[model samples]
Target: MEGIEGGGIGGYWWWAAASSAQLAWGINFYRKGYAGDSRFMPLKAFAVASLFVGATASAAVGILRASGVHSVEDAKEVGASIRSGLGIPRRARDE
Candidate 1:
């Protein structure tokens, strides 16, 4: 996979901008929902917010991999860091 690293700077900017827009729209949806402006919008508001969160977190890890964390051990350390940060259960073989 190319890790969203193509198209040079423009592509990176496009991705960042798009992610920001998605998050903004999600927040707007939540605001409108809580304010009772839309009766059926609260559920979708959570979905969109989670989507943005997942996408951004995934993108950050992808970026670290693409930017030259090449060695296997380095990758493992990165993974461990991620697991720890996310409070994920560590494997028995974890370092």
Candidate 2:
């Protein structure tokens, strides 16, 4: 009820959505777990974990894009001179 306190609506919304999604997925997974299929548990676990990780990464990318801090390309450019300064090994002319 306190209007816009501490991170405002955007932060709270993002946190709530992410957490609810995680809880729902966890419940559904446990409820449907295999009853002796042997390979089923491992397979399902992998799939669920992959889904969670992919979703989180996508959300992070979205936030970064919104902030206009797109990629490592900019950081790489800044460090390029340092990288080059380290120098690559040269082959002997006889080869």
Candidate 3:
């Protein structure tokens, strides 16, 4: 769970690259009319949604890493604090 400050460049780089590639693929599929075809619409939509989620997660992780949050636990704490600040309800964890 090493972050940017911990020299975890490869992990973040991979996440960014993968997210960009997935988003591009999703956009390409939509532009090619794949979404217009009923058979392909569902799959295309799912792909696009998945890509967006991935990209969002990656960006969040990058931000947290850049802010000196190095471990997963620390990231979770920061996220929780953010959610609380925003008046968002915390999810129940099975811990």
Give the best candidate by TM-score.
Answer: 3
Clashing pairs in 2: none
| 61-85 per-residue lDDT for model 1 (tens digits) | 4455445564688778888889999
| Candidate 3 deviant stretches above 4 angstroms | 1-11, 35-37, 71-95
TM-score of 1: 0.42
How are the candidates ranked when ordered by lDDT, highest leading?
Answer: 3, 1, 2
Off by over 4 Å in 1: 1-11, 34-43, 58-62, 69-74, 77-95
Q: Which ten residues in a row have the lowest lDDT in candidate 3?
A: 2-11
The sequence of per-residue lDDT tens digits that candidate 2 reaches over residues 1-95 is: 34233323443455446755765685676677666778677887887776577557656644544444446875454356555677843334413
State the weakest 10-residue window (summed lDDT) of model 1: 2-11
TM-score of candidate 2 versus the correct structure, residues matched by position:
0.43
Model 3 lDDT tens row, 23-49: 687677667665355887787778777
Could you tell me the lDDT of residue 89 within candidate 1? 88
lDDT of each: 0.64, 0.57, 0.71
Model 2 misplaced stretches (Cα beyond 4 Å): 1-27, 30-32, 73-95
Q: List the residue pairs that clash in candidate 1.
A: none
User: What TM-score do all the candidates reach, one by one?
Assistant: 0.42, 0.43, 0.52
